[model samples]
Target: MTPEIAAEADLVLTATRAHRADVVSLQPKALKYTFALADFAHLVDGIDEVPPAQTGFFGPADDSFIGRLVDHIGKRRTAIHPIAEDDADIVDPYRRPPEVFAQMAVHIDAVTPPVVRALTLE
Candidate 1:
């Protein structure tokens, strides 16, 4: 996505636009997740609807599967890295990337629904 498009997407997800007033009060994390879930919706969006046919059928139930997925997806996806890691007491979202900033957007699209549901039930 172009920088303008990415910024626009962020605004929409964050409910900054007047047209999305119905969803404006959504939590920030939920908004982020919604963005991520939307990004990956084309791939494994239906996974949540059905339980796995077999737990370990795909691979061993360990870190490998997750690691592989992140590695594979993370490359094409834009990553948001910390601006600085040496300061233990600071929490700032001031980082930029040497590559494109697609990962954060992808992550936002991928993880939203469950996070929203979990918060709603709480």
Candidate 2:
């Protein structure tokens, strides 16, 4: 993606290790808002004060858990760094064994509930 286009993005979600560098390089300024998918999951997992799941009714979409997660993660970015370059990555399961695929699915599953709650607050 071009730097101009990257700059226009509100947030950037990259799915794997390979795409992370390319996306980060495209918009240096976007680093704070950009996250590898699993990395984001990990980041939010550590935040204890995230609002509890809500139901029934929600206000504007921007005021939801996703928005709050983004804000919290951005604030914590300076203090949090991936222990290894691959720390934020979800390994690619294609062409791999069933066990490998299952492991990847587990990783995704672990992060799904909070993400879904955050996105679907009401």
**Which 10 consecutive residues of model 2 have the lowest summed lDDT?**
53-62
Error of 2 at 82 (Å): 4.7
Give per-model TM-scores.
0.21, 0.62
Q: Please give, for residues 1-122, the per-residue lDDT of candidate 1 as tens digits.
A: 23344333322332112222334333332232222233332223233332222335665432333333323333334543322222111112247673324655444444566434422331
Flag regions of model 2 displaced more than 4 Å: 1-5, 46-69, 79-87
lDDT (Cα) of model 1: 0.33
* lDDT of every predicted structure (CA atoms): 0.33, 0.67
Clashes of each: 13, 0
Report the C-alpha lDDT of model 2 over 8-111, residue by residue, as the tens digit: 87667776756767887877877756777776766665455665433325443344555556666766667877545565567789999999899888877876
